[model samples]
Target chain A: MARKGRAGAALAIAAIGSFFAGTVSTILVAVFAPPLTAIALQFGSAEYFSLMIVGLISSIALAHGSVVKALGMVVLGLLLGLVGTDIYTGTPRFNLGILELSDGLNFVALAVGVFGIAEILRNLENEHDRDVTIKKVSNLLPTRQDWKEMTAPILRGTAIGSALGILPGGGAILASFASYTVEKRISNTPGEFGKGAVAGVAGPESANNAGAQTSFIPMLTLGIPANPVMALMIGAMIVQGIVPGPNVATEQPALFWGIIASMWIGNLMLILLNLPLIGLWVKLLTIPYYMLFPAIIAFCSIGVYSVNSNVFDLYAVAFFGLIGYGLAKLRCEPAPLLLGFVLGPLLEEHLRRAMIMSRGDPMTFLNRPISLVLLLLAAAVLVVVLLPSIRKKRDEVFVEE
Target chain B: MKSLSFSSRDLICGALFIFIGLFFAIQAYGLELGTALRMGPGYFPLVLAGILILLGIIVIIQGTQIEHEPMGPIAWRGLLFILPAPILFGLTVRGLGFVPSLFLTGMVAAFASTRMRPGTALWLVGGLTLFSVIVFSYALGLPFRRFGPWLGQ
Candidate 1:
């Protein structure tokens, strides 16, 4: 669209589609959250443990590359998550006499290292000058034909996004991909998709916005992060001394409602601001990657240091950056690892608590109906991913994107 | 029938997992392992380590069966320069203080790219340090010695 001098039209379509999707999905979240919270309130430790298992297993299914590699990453992440003073026993487990590590490795430092620093390093490997030629955006409004093309896709995308975003692990990314596939498959002008068909951009943009909005459902209701962004939000909540579980709705009604209200306002703000700021965004793309990365490293160091003013965390960032880069080179995805890290302590706590409650009978997982169903679901996911026919299909799907 | 060939990528990946798993397993063994109903700190990690090791073995076996892509070019220059930036910051932040330490960190990171000139790096780092001091120190009111004791501030 930009190459064809229709940048403004494309931008308008995306913004309008996203706004509509965001509004609808926010309403869905508001409607679904209370009931989900009520259901969550009834859950025991066994159910929670099974739920996390389902989450972890599904993460492996969704991760690109070898399933075994992804599983290994998850296990490695779980082990790394355990490196600190044992919560129950008060005996330090993996600190190796580093007093700074008694509180466990800082989550922010690890996240910045793995996702941020590693990505920077990867980009540096292929150093070529980026030549950006942005067309002057003139058509600020979409044509009537554009509206006719986009309406159905926007609605379908909203539905898909709202449903998938409630699932554990990274759903927004999946929702967008699914929406794009659906749009291309259903469109009469399928050949136009890669060439920027109206439905192509409209569907995935709407889907991703809706998915991002509704992903809050799992985070707010169960205190289980739906993605890494949600995990970061949970971290922020902990820092602010707010426990992020089912009780949050009742005890901190203001905060819960405030977050929901902010979603609507934020969507509105984006629509209002984005069109005018489009040129600025284009200009930002003109900045050389080389110049940008040094600033990123500096800011990352300062940000990590400012968290606790502990220099040890900064060292961890460097260490984990190398680890993350190494893992990337080995074709292991980091998403599963991060999710495992977040859920490790919680999963272990629930497992021990559930076992103690059941008097050491492992059958307790099978006996409890909710836990049994969740475990079965996890098993089903694992089995489906492992099936040779399904594995080939999965690879094809990823390759198509 | 084709002869079996192992993928070096998977072999290394599997070995790394196994090595880390064994490390954790040995450490967990040193801790007291209680019964299932009452798991000690070591029990859960020990189980996870075992699973990791098993998965590693599975990975190695799978490597022998499938043809794989060669591991591509590594960012050696990026690794040498980029990885040390944060460690350098950590080592000198308190001693050199935020201004000097951050400047040095940014300067080191800038050289990671072959495209960066020395003059450009100095300018970029200088500007970054100035901006950071203003935002992080003055506006945010984070309590850090802008100039640390080592600077006689």
Candidate 2:
């Protein structure tokens, strides 16, 4: 639609869709969070372990490309996560005797290196003069035809996004992708999808915002991060001396309600601010990639260094950047690795605790009904991903983007 | 008869995974492997290492059967300059201070693209450094020295 000079309409549609989705999802979070927290308070180590297993396996399922490769990436990430001092024995495992290794790798450094620096390198691979043509955005309001086309997709997207957002490891990216796939499949004008149908923009935009809003559910209720952003939020909470668990909702009702209220206000502010700032965003797009990347590199260095005032973290950023680029070259998805990195220590802790509780009985996982259900769900997801028909369909879904 | 062939991308990928898996496994083996009821720090890693090795083998086997696309262009220039930007900053930030270290880092990174002229690179880096100093150091009060003792400040 932007290519066809419907930039204003596209932007407005996206803004409206996102606002609607955000409102609905915020309400869903408010209504559902208390009950969810009550249920989560009952969970034990076995349940937590099974839950993380489901999270890990689903990340693998959702990742693009080979299943075996994704699994390997997760394993590698787990090993990397274990690089610091062992929590149980205080034994330094993979630090190579460096004192910095005792504290383990900085998460921000790893994230910036893998996702940020590696992305810059990829963009630099085919550096050419980009021809950015900005069309004057005149019509901010959607036509009646566009409104008719977008209503059902926005509703469907909101529902899908809200549900998926509550699952650990599921977030805006997966929700938007899933929503786009559904819109394409159900649309009578499926051919118009890649060319920018109104449903294509409206559905994914709505889903993305909705997913982002409701991902807070898992974070607020269970203290389980649904995505990296939630992980960062948990980190911040920990810094503030707030233990993020079911008790948080009860103990800090004001803070919990305040965050939910802010979500709605944030959505409203986004629409109010962004509609007028569309021209500024388009101007930013006109900046040359060559000029932009240097600034990115400088800021990344400063940001990473400021985290702990540790220069070693900066070196780690460089090291992980190389690894990230190498993995990209090798066709491995980095998302699973990142997710694994975040979950690794927690997973180990829960596994060990559960085993200790069960007196070394491996059947303890199956003995607990909730744990059994979660494990079964993980198994079902793995099996479905491995199926030949679904595998092909999965590839096709990714290829559309 | 079909010739035995392998996807080089997968072949290299599998070898990398196997190598890393082995590296972790050997280290874990040196640690105490406690019972399942009370897993030592190493036990969990050892299990993960084993899974990684198995997955690597599966990837290798699959590579032999499947004909994959070529690996395409490697970012040699980007790798040459871009990877060092942070390392350079790390090395010099304390000694040279935030301003010069950042300027140097930006200058190096700017050249990652072949399109960047030396003059353009210098201008871009200079501007970035100025902006960062104003925002990060002055405004945000990140306790970075504008000029370190090495600069006789």
Candidate 3:
């Protein structure tokens, strides 16, 4: 296996690039895509439902696990998503009789609980005193040859990131992950992947960064949020008395252009901040887990509690964190579950709309051209998963990294 | 070992899936499924649950058929500390406020590890609580209390 430190270093730096890159890109897409860049504006409910299904399929297919477990996780997520008040009927589905749950479980708290707090619990399983090498601070820069190899992957990653970022629910995380898989497959030395191949870092970093920037396209132009973050942005714009959608390009030209300018500035700031921060960030890895975990808990508790200033959110996080730990033990990856959770409401809404539009005709999904095409693509993904050669390749790519 | 023997991991996973799938399907069965076109709230969930149950049964069959890798012992230690830490924070946050709740949560969570020293845990709790209070309460201007309910915010 590749040494943990080396891989951690690469992922950490790449993560920093990705986090801001998304924020910047989302802000800029409005300015750059003059016409508001929404190819999916003509999307019908059938097409929208098909698109969400595609997302569900990709999330499961991309993750490493038995099909049953992954599907179960997705179903669980969807069920959880249905917990809030149903929009059409004004009836709460699964609020467990708690008034606090009327609006559904808080997304931020749930994410923090599952990904962050649960991760800490997992780490504590095999916890050991970390060996600190304080005296030997390694060179942060890649060698000359490293730069040469990284150039192509970075470009490829950027391109992929930009394209996928515009797709609803295909955010920076998916872009980076998909980029890494593609990079690993195309690399000359595939065996070097788990061992911290520089390309693994470079490709994903660039892709995630680019994806983060470009995902704003649908939000800016069509005003349909492609991801949860975009949903928040749309909410913010609405609150600020700015009506998003196609007319924003014509009515609010200056505001659109200004946001784009800020995206570039944000990117510049990220680069400046990252270089000096690298050393300090790496130093974090050397801290022993016991000291580290409590601190993580400290931050998580405060953060979860602060959201809506609701203590119930904290309880929700705790519950989810426990479930997360159980799922982790079962090797049911949570990433797909998370994506499913985020997309669940949309999926249901689209399905309901499509059904209503079609007057209960189940064949509508098959009949609609765009919806049929998306379903075909989803079918292709399933076929690819079942293929023995692709399965082997998936195994190779799905290692500890 | 033959490929047909039950694998512990797959069996547990399969059973869990089957149980959850059945639960949702049965519950939604009571609700109006409507026609496929009209699509009641229960329709989509019922369809998904059916698929899930089918997949679960497949996994169960696979479990019975295959020899599998051994499952790891679940870390009860980690679960004990990590699970309740947040609930404690929840119960206390409103009455005690952010600072004390976080500190207590951290201290309780610290013991999840057998290796944690009280001195280090104390320091960590203190340092993290202080930083968060300043950053979250002071810098962010969050309306939640640093100390409230008992102290009257």
Best by the TM-score measure: 1
Clashes of each: 0, 0, 9
Global CA lDDT of candidate 1, please? 0.88
lDDT, residue A320, model 2: 94
> Residue B1, candidate 2: how far off, in angstroms?
8.7
What DockQ, between 0 and 1, does each candidate earn?
Answer: 0.84, 0.87, 0.66
> What ranges in model 3 sit over 4 Å off?
A1-38, A129-135, A141-153, A164-204, A215-263, B65-67, B151-153
After the best TM-score superposition of candidate 1, give how far the Cα of residue A113 lies from its true spot, in angstroms: 0.9
lDDT of each: 0.88, 0.88, 0.73
TM-score of chain B of each: 0.95, 0.96, 0.94
Better of 2 and 3 by TM-score: 2
Alpha-carbon deviation at A394 in model 3, angstroms: 0.7
lDDT of 3 at A58: 62
The iRMS of model 3 comes to 1.5
Kindly report the docking quality category of candidate 3.
medium
Residue pairs clashing in model 2 are none
